[model samples]
Target: MAPSLREGVSQARSFEFLRLGRQAPWLVLGLGLLLGPGAFPHRARAAPASGADPAALLEQGREAYEMLECPKAVASFRKVLAHPKATPAQRVEAYVGQAWCQVVEGNEALARETLQKALEIRPDYPVSPDLSPKLAAVLEAAQRDFRARAKVEIDLDVTARGAPPELGMRVRDPAGQVNEVLVRYRTDGEWREVAAHSEGASLWTARLEGAAAGTLPLYVETKNRYGFVSGREGTAESPVAVRVEPAAVSAALAPPAATGAASGTALTPLAWTAAGLAVATVGAGTFFGLKAKEEEARFNGDPSQFGSHDEALAVGRSAQRNATTATVLFVSAGVLAATSGLLFVVDGSHGPAGDAVEPGFAAAAMPLHGGGLFALAGRF
Candidate 1:
């Protein structure tokens, strides 16, 4: 090999070793962790106070875990961390609890990192004896794996369902183009990658999208300029399970039910009102129409009866009022009738053959505040 190439190879190996050196402490810790619970050489921190007990939260997380509600369990563990006066031991408990959940949720890398954090808080921390052997193994592997890589801080989104499943994940993203965050999702037995862009300081996000309202599995990773990848990886410890469900319609935002009938014959209130308005307007039109015709006859009966120009003008004015009133009522009747007809047709289409609304009687005389005759009967 040329001296220059040899020198380049040497430099590459040196960089690799240097990188491995930085990870050495975590590796040693991971090996010790492999010894299993009650074996670490650190003192036990006292449990939290009764008033600030984290045990309940731990139990809550545990129950969620057993039920395969990893997201809920993660939440409980987070609450433990947020507890007002959680002790170091309690904090460790929370960390471990979350790690356990992360493993089951297919975020094995995250689980590993969490366990490492717990170990930092208490090097001698032991696994809970109450944990099942299967879970113990998961925890064991996660801790062992953490030694292999450094982890970035992350927050996972676990919404049950919302518009496109409110994909909100917060993770530490270095502020540079050289490092890129990528989210990979597994669907239909295929893995696809999507770029996760920076949202804020150290926050990278990729909105999760689902197809056909189903479950999706996805994980986040970051690649540096050096081609080194670090981030959460799915393992038995963290099998990402996200359910994509149809978006719920809030009562406030729900679309109105069709005025049309499910069986094809139901009429909306508007449709019914339109029909009544058409009938009422038609009735008015008929009455006015007759009055107009009557006035016309009276005028033709004796044009000479008007003795002066003023008298003729007076008769003409009366005829004009009659004509105008009749014209308005007739126009209104045509419009309302058309509207009602359209409504009725639409309502009928929504109903099944047997569900069509039976003919209803026309508005029986509307009762006025004071006794009055709206209409005794229709002539036409």
Candidate 2:
């Protein structure tokens, strides 16, 4: 394979590795949960404190919990649990309150188990109790709701014509489940499903339709086999926004209508002019150089004839002058041709109407005209 192809593949692999490294923390967290919490370090229980006011701490914890202050409530509850004078009922309530605070802060599983421990401690704990009923409701809601996340990875293959003349997408869920993704493209104030989900590895391919292309917001939603729709997670990976830009759109869309058209027309003529100048320069130089060599050969062959010698000397001098003139013209033409060619390339790559046109065609054209005048003088 070519060096460029090798470099591209290496870059792609490096990017993939970096992305996976970033997601390593989430993977480890999931694996730890799957392996069971007992496999991890157990949270240390707060030791019993001597002569602490249990009622006051419970009230403080309740206030913190109501205010949605999870850390503060957890700290106050721990203090209440640690009090030696606290009854079994009060201790259970403290655990239950801590669990409720955890649920409010979005730690669902820990909250459920903490509530379970409270129930186990006091089986007669009233399910209809004000705080207990509210905690139960929160847990039930969490369980009933289907939480899901998704991410899209885009790989742009740059070609000679343009970068990613076509577009595609791949979507993956947290459970390592791949789904055939469809994208509804937004174009000219309207939305259409440009690409249908084909049988592939969660990869959907679509061709770019026009020269004016941008990032189209594609709404992607998927249903599982059980018909449960994935709820939107506000995280970066979920409902990934893919940005697609067609190559050289700005160049193609250059305006000031008349100027743009003139510049575009001028570009082709400039290219051909440069090419013609270069070929002419090279041919002129070569022809004059060969004639000078022939004149030198005749002078060397008959040096004995004084009259012929003077004539040959004049012929040699004239040939030398012609060669010198050709060399100067060749060099001048070459520089102008190269400059024009460079301008044409730059104008073609970017838009032709701005700073690009001013320096290249405008500024250099004057010097080029002067050079042509000098070449005409040399010809005379």
Candidate 3:
């Protein structure tokens, strides 16, 4: 018949002892020579401090287990578990190590209990197949029991419904430990937070209004009374998305606008009058200038034909008066044209219709029959 698990472990230890015992004679003589007869039985050293490195403690515990020191291994593992700054992974590993020691000591019940605590920290903790058959069987039993335990978690159900299109979220906190629930949502580019109100038994609701049509990313978090988050459905880094549809309207809406075309503005009457006056003065100035030239030409052509010196003087004075009249008319035309151009420019702001003409004047003198004729022109 095959040996039991404990019997097999005991037999293996016996074989290791026999192998070491072969060199014990020389080892004992050497130790006696180094420390007199008083060192026949050595005293055990003090345990490591609780504040020691958890990883170091865990390694020490594993080495003790390999040397068949179950009690010392258990103590080292407990120190790792008791460390204040021990990580979850480290604590879980320590618990597993203690459970292995308990299994080797023939305490299967205590080993199973220890394994359950490790599973509480990490339910997916693997049961290594390389473990001894007795320890593997104990680990499998603990995993089965852990799965059969009751579940306590928060649940969130989201729906986009209702008139005017409000987003509704239904939350359930079965553990009854959640003090408050909130939803963080984003419509365009900014994220917003809203508190949820209790609606019914194990049911809470949050309504979000005025969301545009698109994919909205959101997350739900349940907090304790102290404002620390206890449970969460989604996170800010990885948010859940829901579709928002556009609202529909009836076909029979309001009528078209009453005024469609933009009102236009024309040049004022005052501006038109100034322009007309400018043109009339230019025509009058040209006529007077031609008359001045004709008078001078006739007077110079025949001095005796004038019939008398007085007539000739009268003709010369008449030519001088015509020339002065032409000069005055041309000056008046330039002033009138400038006024017209200024008015046009001011009125141009009312509309964009005609080209802008700059107001300017040019004068030239030509010698005709030993007499000068002045000509002036203006643009408006």
Candidate 4:
């Protein structure tokens, strides 16, 4: 027969309880806590909470400051700054809040230091009216300190001559951290960059070789040692407009022939020299021709007036020789004169000088061996 109910209960209680009975509840609780809500049973997890939002922290900090809880405000602001997700504006706001907290606690030195951090983030950030007058004073002093540390000034000089455009810059960087300056420019095409060479402390120059003559859009960028842009005169989007002279452009585009003509010195001198030579030859020819004519006239006037036939023959021969000599000189003069005139025409046609003076020509015919000689002279 089955044991009676009281006896059975007592006996069952005496049998040791299953090990799970005491530990299972605690085990489940431990698992639930470790896995967190909605976590898979097989994939245990830590707590589900994420990092505090930077924007929320910033707001909370502002509220804490308004309530005059300087320590809590500073704690919230510091958390916002330490968060990686914080934006530049949020960072600046946090620094300002923390600085104001320091000022309220009578920690003026620390307050100025904190304000300096905010100014480094944004030098132009206005002092908030919520800040105490003392804090505002600290902020101003912090700004002055930041400016002293990071001030950058750029002075640019652009010179466009007939060749290429040259750019010079004087950078007043009190921090002495600027390592280089770059000249950014463009003509009709895309923007280009040329590295500037340092001439001395704060002085730099760059020559843009292929920059054409037109409206050159340009800007100067100063860089630090690691190539971080430290300063800018103008941005690439809104560059400084510089007008390049058209005269220089024209000269650059001119052809070699055009270049020679512009000077116009080469052929003009040669033409003049040829003309002078021709004049001398012609004068000599004329003198010989006159002597020949005079001798011939005397010989023809009286044959019997000669002492003998041989004497008359000699006189005639002498006249003929003179005539021949005159003819040869005349021919040479004519050739030289023609060459001079041709040279002058060539020079005037090609030269930058528009007009040339017309050369004069003279010709004389001889008795028998007669070819007229001509000489020409002209100003080129």
lDDT of 3 by residue, 62-126 (tens): 65765657799889899999999788878887998888777667788998899988776665566
Which of candidates 3 and 4 reaches a greater TM-score?
A: 4
* lDDT digits (tens) for residues 1-380 of candidate 1: 55698899999999999999999868755633443233212334434323325766776665565455678878878988998877777787788767766655567677777887775555434555655565566666754554344345556554323564444456654322127677777766677678876776665556555533567777666665444454454533366775555664322233334444344444566787987888888888788778777777777677677788787777667877988897898898888888888876676544455444443322223232234323332111
Q: What are the runs in model 4 whose C-alpha is more than 4 Å off?
A: 1-51, 127-133, 158-166, 174-380
lDDT of 4 by residue, 217-310 (tens): 8998877654456678888889976555455553443332323335354788899999999999999999999999999998999677899989
Q: Clash number for every model? A: 17, 0, 0, 0
Q: Deviation in angstroms for 85 in model 4? A: 2.5
Q: Give candidate 1's error at residue 14 in angstroms.
A: 41
User: Per-residue CA lDDT of candidate 2, range 35-144, in tens?
Assistant: 22331113354444334589677767765654456699789889988888887667877987777767656687887667655543443244443234445565444333
List per-prediction Cα lDDT, in the order shown. Answer: 0.61, 0.54, 0.67, 0.70
Please identify model 2 stretches exceeding 4 Å from their true place: 1-267, 304-307, 352-380
Choose the strongest candidate by TM-score: 4
**For model 3, what is the error of residue 221's alpha carbon versus the real structure, in angstroms, after optimal superposition?**
10
Higher TM-score: candidate 2 or 4?
4
Poorly placed runs, candidate 1 (over 4 Å): 1-150, 160-163, 173-178, 233-238, 249-380
